[model samples]
Target chain A: MDSIKVFAPGTVANVACGFDVIGLALDAPGDEMIIRRSEVPGVRISAVHGADLPLEASRNVAGVAVQALLQKLEDPKAGFEIEIFKNIHPGSGIGSSAASSAGAVVGVNLLLGEPFSRKQLVRFAMEGERLASGAAHADNVAPAILGGFTLVRSYRPLDITALHTPKDLWVTVIHPQIEVKTSDAREILKQKVLMTDAIRQWGNVGALVAGLYQENYDLISRSLEDVIVEPIRSILIPAFHELKLRCKEAGALGGGISGSGPSVFMLSKGEESARKVADTMNQVYAPLGVDYKIYVSQINTEGVKVIG
Target chain B: MDSIKVFAPGTVANVACGFDVIGLALDAPGDEMIIRRSEVPGVRISAVHGADLPLEASRNVAGVAVQALLQKLEDPKAGFEIEIFKNIHPGSGIGSSAASSAGAVVGVNLLLGEPFSRKQLVRFAMEGERLASGAAHADNVAPAILGGFTLVRSYRPLDITALHTPKDLWVTVIHPQIEVKTSDAREILKQKVLMTDAIRQWGNVGALVAGLYQENYDLISRSLEDVIVEPIRSILIPAFHELKLRCKEAGALGGGISGSGPSVFMLSKGEESARKVADTMNQVYAPLGVDYKIYVSQINTEGVKVIG
Candidate 1:
C-alpha cells in the first residue's frame, strides 16, 4: 500500500490526583491522519480539522515524530505526505499532542515496514512533543501508543509502562466552551509546595495505588480526591465546583479536572450512573449560557487504532 | 487446656507510600499471647512482653479488644488468662498494636464460639486500637487480621480491601536502635501540601498499584518511591540517608520507612539483593553506633493466623 489512514482516539492526561504521571485512553472520538510514502525524507503536513496549527516540522508534534522515525532509517531519503484530523482541541487535557504524535508515528512506521517495536515508536513520538512543550514528557504519548492506563515513570530513559485499568470504570468527560492555553495553565503552577499538603497528597497517593490493585472501588473513589491541583485549577474551568458536586450527588464514583482544565471528568459506577452524571453536569452548565460538550464514555481500554 | 498459646506476626504498617492505608503481616518471629478461660464478663490482661506495657484491660491493646468483643455478647460473662509472647517491639512500626488486637480478637472470638467473620474480627481489632490512638485507623489491623496488603479506605464504616502482592518481591528491612513515637513522628508533619508534589505522589501510587497487578517489577521498583513521608521521617532515623544511599548503590529497588518508622525497608529482585541490602544498611549504621534489627524476608501473603 502506498498510503494509510489511521485514527487516534482522545486521551485524558494527568488523571486526577495522579497528575503528569497517569494517562488513560478515551474512547471518545479524537484526531486522525493519513500518511503516504514519498521520495523526500522530511514530512509534508496539512491539517483537515484543528484550528491553524503550524505545519513546519519544527513547530508541529506529529511532524517531529515522523521526522525522527524517518531519520532512523538506513535510507533517510524516505518521505511521507501527512494529513492530520484534529478533532480533540489542544489544552483539553485530552492528549492532543499525543494523538497527533502517536498518529504520525504509527502511520509512518507502518509505511516503513514496521522496523521498530511499539516502545521504539513511542520514543520516536517524544520528539514530536519536544517542539511544543519545552520538555518531552511521555504521559500523553505512552497511553496513546500502548492503550489502557499508562505511567511515564522516567523521561530520561523514556520508561513507559501500561497499567491494567479496571473493566468496570466508566469515564464521563465535559469540555467547557471556555479556552485555556496549555502554556498559560502550566504557568499558573507554583514551583514549590507546602510540606503538609505534600504529605496528605502522598497519603492519598498511597491509598489510591493500593485501591487499584485490590479493585476496591470505594477506596479508589475516596482516593480520587485532589486537595492540591483540583482546587487551584478548578478556577479556570466554568462552573467547576457546582458541576462536580452535582455529578457526585447524581451517583459519580468521583471526578476532578481533566489535566490543566477547562475540561472536567468524573468516574461513575455503571452506564445508568454515567448517564445520570452526564445529565447532572450538563444541567449545571445549562444556565452558564456557554457552549459545552459532554461525553459519557467508558474507559478506553483499546486506544489508538485503524480507521480507513 | 487452661490457657491457649497464640502467635501473632509482626507487620509492616503503612508500607512505603501506603501511609494510613496499607500494611502487611510478616512471617514467624512475632508477638505471642496466651488467653485462658475466666468466669467474669470483664477481660483481665497480663503481658509477658518485656516492655512496660500496662497489664490492665483498659490499658492493654489485647485486653481492650477482648473486652469489647465480650461486651457485644448477650451473656457478657467471659473469663480468660492472657499471656503475650513479645517478639515484635511496640514502637518498631511493625504493627505492634495490631498484632495484639488481632491476637486478642482471635483468642476471644474462638472462646466465644466464633461470633464474627475474619473481617468482623478486624472490626474487633480496631476497637482495641481506639484505646491507644484516639483514631481507630485500620491500616495495620486489617493487614494483620487478613494478611497480605490491605487497603483501609475508611475507618468509620470499616471498608477494607486486600490486594495481590507479587511473590518475586524480596524485602530487606533495617530497624535502627533509635526510637520514635508515632504521635511525635506524626506531629512533625505539616497539614498541607504543594499541588505538584501531591500530583506526583498519586501518579506513583497508581503506578505502584498497576505494577503489582501487571507484575511489572521495574515499575514496582520505580513506583516504590515515597516522595512525601520518607524525607520527613528519615530525618529521625540517624544516617538514614547513608543507609538508603548504600542500599541503592548495592542495587536495591527503591524503598523507605516500613511504617511510621525507624525501620527502613526496601524490596529487592532476589534473595542475594535482599541480603546485600541488609548488609549495606548494617554498614551505614556502624558509624552512627546504632544497633540494628534486620528482616531479609519476602512478602507474606498469609495474614493473621493461630500458631499452628
Candidate 2:
C-alpha cells in the first residue's frame, strides 16, 4: 500500500436550539486523511499512532465511505490505503465520526476524480455514519463537508444547506475527560416535552436566529439560555454552572454543554474573551480533578482539507 | 375637554424564538385612541367599543399606561379620558392590548408636552399590560411604540432596542375566532425545557435573523419553522396542521401561532402569496365555526400613526 490524503475539520453540533439539525465547522485542529493506491481492490485503515479501525468495508466508517465512493466510480478494480491523523477525539461531541466519514468520502472521491456534489457526497458519508451511531444523522457530516453554518433539514435523503455565519464570531470548546455516551444521554431525555417548554424553546430559537443575523450580541447572550435540556444534562456534568457563570463573567457571551455531556462550549466576540473563556473552563475543572483538552478556534469556513 | 387622537397598529409578539422578548409591528387594522385632556386628575378612562376591555382606570390597560405616564409628572394634575376604536379584535394574539397601551401613552404624553423618551414610553406601556395581564412585558408594546422590529430585553423599567426590518418582507395574519384564554394558555406551560430543545430554538432563531438580513425568501421560509412552540400550541388550535399545511401550500414560507392563541401568522414574499394565505386560513376555519379576520400588510415600519 502506498499513500494518499483526506482531511476533515472538527464541528459543533446541537448548536444552541438547532439540535440534531444544525452544526458549524471549526477552523483549527482537524484530522488529516491519507489514502494510498493499493492492489486487489481491498481497503486498509490506520488512525494516528497506528491505531487501526476495522478493515471490513461494511464495518468501518471510513472504509464504507471509500467503498461507496469507489462504487460510484467505474471499474472498482483499484484499492486504496487510508491513514487518519486523529486530532479530534472520538467522543468529544465535536463531530468525531463525522470527520472520518466526511474525510473518507472526500478523500476517496478526490482519488477517483471528484464526481459528486458536496451535497451528494453527504449520503455516502451518512451511510458510513450508520456503522458507529446506529443511525445516519447529517447534523455533523453536512456541516463538516459543506463548511460554514449548516442545517440538515432531512436526514434520510440528506438535505444540507449552509446558513450565513458571522465573520468575527469566536468559539471555545472545553471537553472534560468524563465520557457520556450519546446513546445513554439520548435515552435520559424525555421524549415528550411540555407545551410551555416548547413555546419557550421556539421563542428562544427565533431570538437566537435573529441575534445571529443582526449581530446583536446581547440578544445572542440572552438567547443562549436553554431552560429545556441544559438543566437536566448539566446535572450529569459537575461544575456546569460554574463554567457558564465564569465564562459569562470573563466577558464570554455564553457557553453551554457541547452536545450530550462533559464537553461545554463558549462563544465570544474576540480573542481576549475566547482565551478568558478557556481559562475559566480550566479553573472550573481544576478542583474537580478533571483533566481536559481545550479548543480555541474560529468557525471553520474551509472544511475537510486533504493532506497532500 | 378636547380629545387628542393617537393610533397604534397591531403587532406580532414572541416573534417565534425570542419568546416574551421580541416582537414586530404590523401596518394595518390598528386601534385608535382618543385622549381628552381634563381637569379631573389621576387619569380616567372609558372604553366605547373594542375587545370588551375594562373601562376603569385600574383595570383598563390604556388607563394604566396613562396613569403611569402622568404620575411621573410633577403635580400629577392632568386627567385623561381615553376611548378606543377597536379594529384588531381581542384574543387575536396580535398584541391587542399593546396597541391600546402604546397609543394611550403616546397620546397622553403628547398632551403633557412630551415629557419622556420613547424608551420611557415603552415602560409606561408596560404599566398598562401589567394591569391587564398581571405581568409587565414589553415584547409587544416596545415595538408598537417604537416601530419596526423591537427586542424587549426586560419589562421592569423596559429595556428595548429596535432592529432594521428588511423592506421586501410581507406578513399575512389569520385570526380564527377560537378563543384560548391567555392566562389559561400560559398556565398549562411547563417550567423546564430540555437543553437540547433550547439549542434547537437558538439555531432556528439564528437562522431567522439571517433570513431577515439577507431577505432570502426560501431561507426565511425554512428558518420560519417553530419546532418548540408551534408544535405544542398548535395542538390547542384545531386543524392547526391543516392550516399550516394550507398556508405553506398557498405560498407562505411557514405559519405559527401569532402570539399565544387562535391566530396564526404566515410570512410571504409579495401581495399574491400574502392574499393567498389569508384565503387559505379562512378556508381552514370555515369548517370549524372559527370565523376569521385576516390582514395583508407589510413589515409595519411605522408602528403607530397619529390620527389627525
Candidate 3:
C-alpha cells in the first residue's frame, strides 16, 4: 500500500507505584495520521490539522520518530509524508507526544513492508520522547507501541516487558485545561529518597504486578500507592488531593497524576465504575470553574492500529 | 491432638531486587519442632537440641512467637511446651530464626485444633523477628509462614501476598561458616539512596513478580539484580563476587547475599541446573579454605507443615 491511515492511542505513565517504569494504553482520545510514500528522499510533515503544531519535519515529534526509524534501513531509499489529525492535546500529560510518535513509526513500518518489530518501533518512538522532553523515557512510548500494561525493566539496554492485562480493567481520565511542565514537575522531586520509603514503594510495585497477573481487584487497589513522586508533583495540579480521594470513594481502584499532570487517571474494575469515577471528577472540578475533558474507556489492548 | 510435630523451611529474603520486601521458601535445610499441650498457664521452651539457645520463654524466639499467638486469644488460658530440633544455623542469613518461630506457631496452632490461618501466623512469627533483629521486618517470616514466594506489601497493618511459584524452579545456597550480625549489616547500609537507582531497582521488582507469574525463566534471570544492598553487603561474605560469577557461568539464573549476608543463594530453572550451581559454589570456595555448607532444593510451596 502506498498510503496508510492509522490511529495511535494515548497512555498513562508511572501507574502510581511504578514511576518511570510502568505504563498502560488508553482506548480513546488518540491521534489519527495518514502516511504516504513520497518521491523525495527524506521524511516530511506535509500537513497538520486540529492542533496548531509545527509542520517542519525537523521540529515535529512524529518527524523525529520517523527519521529515527528510517536511519535503521540499510539502503535508505524510502521517504514519506505524514499528515496528523491530532485529537490528544500536547502537555495534557496523557502521552500526547507519544501518540504522534508511536503512530508515525507504526504507519511507516507497515508501509515499508514491516521492517521492524513493535519493540524496535519503541526505540524509534523514544527519539520523539527525547525531543519532547530532554530524556529518552520509554514509560509512555513502550505501552503506546506494545499495548496494555508494560514494565520498562531496564533503560541502558532498553528492556521492556508486556505484563498481563485484566479484561475487566477500565480507565477514567480527566484533563484539566492547565499546563504542568514535565521538566518543572521533575525538578520538584528530591534527588534522594529514604531507603525505608523506597522499600515500601518497591513492595507496592511488586504486588501491583502480581495483582495484574492474578486479576485480583482488591490486591490491585491495595497496591496502587505512590510514596515517592506523587506527594511532591501533586502540588502542581489543582485540587489533586480531593480529586483522588473522591475518585477512590466513588469506587475507583486508585489513581494518581498521569505523567507530569494536570491530567489525572483512575483505574476501575469495570466500565460502570469507571464512568462513575468520571462523574465524580466533574463534581470535584466543577465548583472551581475549571475547563476540563473527561473520558471513560476500557484498557486498550491494541496500541497503534490501521484505520484505512 | 494434644501433641504436634512440624517442619518449617528456611527462606531467602531480599531476593536481589526486592530488598526488605520479597522472599521465597526452600524445600530442605529447615527446622523441626514438637509442640505439646501443657497444664501450665503460659508458653515454655522445655527442650533444645542441635543448637545453643536460651530456654526461657521470653528469651527464645519460638517461645516469644507462640506467646504472641497465645496473647491473641480472648481468654488467654491456653498453654504450650515447645521442643526444638534446630537445623538451620543462626546468623547464616537463611531465616534461621524465622524457621523456629514459624515452626513453633504452626505446631501450636495444629495442636490447638488450628486456631489461626497461615497469614495470621506471619504476624506472630514477626514478633520473633523483632526479638531476633530488633526490627519487625516481615521479608523472611512471611515466606516461612505462607510458602512459595511472598511479598510484604506493607508493614503497617501488615499486608502479605503469596506469589506464584514455578514448578521447575530450584535453589542452590552456600552458607560459609561465619557470623554477620543483622544489626551490623543494617548499619552498613546508607539511609538514603539515589532516586535513579531506586527507580531501576523497582523496575526489576515489578518485572520479577511478572516473571514469577508467567514462569519465564530468562525474565526471572534478568530481573534478579540488586543495585542497592548487595553491593555493600557482599563485602561481608568471603569471595562472594567470584562465587556469583562462577555460578552464573555454570547456568544458574542469578543470586546475591541471602538475607543479611555470609550465605549466598542462586536460583536455577531445574534441579539439575541447581546441582551444577552448587558444584560451582564449591569450586569457588574450596580453594580459599572457607568452611561452607551447601544445599540444593526445589522451591517450597508448603511453608510450615505438620510432621506428626
Looking at candidate 2, what is the lDDT of residue A294? 89
The CAPRI class of candidate 3 is high
TM-score of every model? 0.90, 0.83, 0.97
- What are the per-residue Cα lDDT tens digits for candidate 2 across B180-274? 88887776666665645554555555556556666767766775655556666777787889888988898888757777877777788887888
Which regions of candidate 3 are displaced past 4 Å?
Answer: B75-77
lDDT of 1 by residue, B43-128 (tens): 78755666678888888888888777776765655677688777777777777788899887887777667777778888778887
What TM-score does prediction 2 earn?
Answer: 0.83
Better of 2 and 3 by TM-score: 3
Report residue B218 deviation for candidate 2 (angstroms): 2.5
Rate residue B143 of model 2 by lDDT. Answer: 84
Candidate 2 structure quality by residue, lDDT tens digits, A128-223 = 778778887787888789887786654333446677667777899988878888898788777656645655555555556566666777777776
TM-score of chain B of each: 0.92, 0.93, 0.98
Per-residue C-alpha lDDT of model 3 across residues A61-123, encoded as one tens digit per residue: 999999999988854789999999998999999999999999999999999999899999999
DockQ of each: 0.46, 0.29, 0.92
**lDDT scores of the candidates, listed in order:** 0.76, 0.75, 0.93
Best by DockQ: 3
Candidate 3 chain A worst ten-residue window by lDDT: A69-78
Per-candidate RMSD, Å? 3.0, 4.3, 1.4
Writing each residue's lDDT as its tens digit, candidate 3 over B56-164 gives 9998999999889988965467889999999999999999999999999888888777788989888999899889889877888888988999998998868889999
- How far residue B88's Cα lies from its native spot in candidate 3, in Å, is 0.2
Write down the lDDT that model 3 would get: 0.93
